[model samples]
Target chain A: MENDKQKFRLLDTLYILMMIVPIVFGIVLKILTTPQSEGIAISGAKIFFTINLPIQNLPITESQIHSWLVMIAITGLCLFLTHGLKEKADTKRQHIAEWIVENAQKLVIDNMGDYFSGFAPFIAAILSLSAFSSLLALFGLYAPTSDVNVTAGWAILVFFLITYYKMKCGPVVYAKSFGEPVPFLAPLNIISEFATPVSMAFRHYGNVLSGSVISVLLAVGLQGLSSMVLGKLPGFLGEFPLFQIGIPAVLSIYFDVFSGVLQAYIFAMLTMLYVAGAFPADEYFRRKAKKSTI
Target chain B: MLELAIGIILGSCALGAGVAMIAGIGPGIGEGNAVAKACEAIGRQPECKGSVTTTMLMGCAVAETTGLYALVIAILLIFVAPGRLVDILMETIK
Candidate 1:
């Protein structure tokens, strides 16, 4: 018991250090480094720093930096949640962690069946990354999801997974399946197959980006309206954006918190559905039976 | 001539954005119908409320895609088209 306690303490220390180091390092880097981007970045994520390599210059943008921070934060949360987990679940953190894991596992099993239960972690990772990345917008940071490239990367990965699973039945069979009902529809099948990733990426990226864009437009409009309404006041108080205070908070709740989390859930759910649909139940069972026979 | 050309282009851009937003009506009606059906389903089987809500949300998100695409086009027209068009026209005239 004493040895176990010592081990727990060491792990706790490590977790704390792991959480602190990246954040501190990021802050130091941000303060010390001169921003390499020149000229006004009109829209989209602004380039923060450009690293000149022998191969090509890598321009790090706001989305990349903020995503890195979100990843670090997620890692820290995981560490904190799993820190000193006991078998009997004495602590609240342990219960929370167990509950989260149990629900995620159950969701995967329910959606994709028992055969694909292994996908729970992947789906959970997607859900957390999408959710937290979009949530970053609440803190006035550039959300990585708002940049179509990030969501496109995730969608493309999902598309590849779907394609790989579909091809497991054999590439010839898969290609033939595309022309089902009519060989003339082969081109349409190909287009639809390609459309999956594009649609998923655009759906997620557009929702988050539109939310932010609308918020900015509303804020600017509100400021102008407020100045027009309150301009009669004397001194500096006249220009104060009085009307901009409470109105935006109402919109923020819908645009940021609700829409961000909902989009994340939809994206993860769609990915699970598409991937599971790629491999039919009969094929899965046949493979399982074959393995069992061996 | 340049000022008049710029004005016409900007005005058309605004008009195009407004027209693009007409796509919003489809999703609005679709989601309303979806919610109404979901309400009926829940009323019939209250215990299935959780599943019904989830399905409704997923359907609504999918339905909203067309509206979102239109919004994106409208945003591009309003914010991007005017500037680019005006700039191109100025260069051509010069």
Candidate 2:
């Protein structure tokens, strides 16, 4: 473990840059470009980039372009940085793939106590992507995690996967897993199943959007105090922070690291739980147990 | 005008960012809790380390996302402060 720690790698640097550089760039940029009058400048459509899908008037602007330039540059640089680096993406991905295939199945059997190894990657990817997106938002770019479509798409896909997993666990028993009493409640069970994806998607996106909005408000509001004191100094000197490293730093600790990961976990955990619930009981004792419980 | 206006943009960006960073609070507590729980689990069931570790890490990664978003916002605020420059421009006009 110590040897592994000692072996400094590009991904580490890449991740650090991913974490630090963007904020630095954004801070420097924001300080340089912030305007006083919000009315006129804030208006008009700002377009960043366009794809096949049309967004009537995009929210992108020249400043946003410059902002994204820094972001894209870092991401692009990461690719180059990792290229031919000791730990190549391809190698790590391949090794991960192999490891997951080899150990994941056995581990699932041992721990999860049932089958379904094929879908583990999907779970991992969605969970990680959500986490990464929230982290990316810290740099001021619109977070993919905050996008309802992105999250909803993921949730719906997960729903189908769970259904598939349920089918695979036991075809005859799959339908029986739901609406156990009588048969009229089948629609209610189906609706409840449908509710899973909606909750799954909204849970993540809402958390991110609320965090983004609230934080923006608080940080914006903090300036209100400074603004009140502006030009109030004896010689019209600017108001200096009480302590350069205290309150804001504390705030940083709270917002930048904690909420980001929690929401991601919540999103993924809910999906997994829903999936786990879909599994049929392994009834080895009775032939009648194979029949539909519904 | 442009340069001074540009400078204040960083303030708003920082504000936005500082706000963004608030989300980190949840994750910090969460990851700590997760680590503690994982340690407890390891002590309780050493044989289940692999599964426990994997699950814990995966959960931790998810918990970390909110912080990431805030970090991004904070970065954008501190580094770019796009609105800061806009303020400078307003100052010049004033």
Best by TM-score: 1
Model 2, C-alpha of A91: deviation from truth (Å): 13
Candidate 2 lDDT, tens digit per residue, A219-287? 555665665656366553565533332555455446555666777766766666667666554553244
Candidate 2 docks at the CAPRI level of: incorrect
Q: Please, what are the lDDT tens digits per residue for candidate 1 over residues B1-94?
A: 7678888999999999999999999999999999999999999999999999999999999999899889878978987899899889979988
Predicted structure 1: lDDT: 0.87
- Range of the 10 consecutive residues with the lowest summed lDDT in candidate 2 chain B: B72-81
Lowest lDDT block of 10, candidate 2 chain A: A39-48
Q: Score the docking of each candidate (DockQ).
A: 0.66, 0.05
Q: Given candidate 1, what's the lDDT at residue A255? A: 85
Docking class of 1: medium
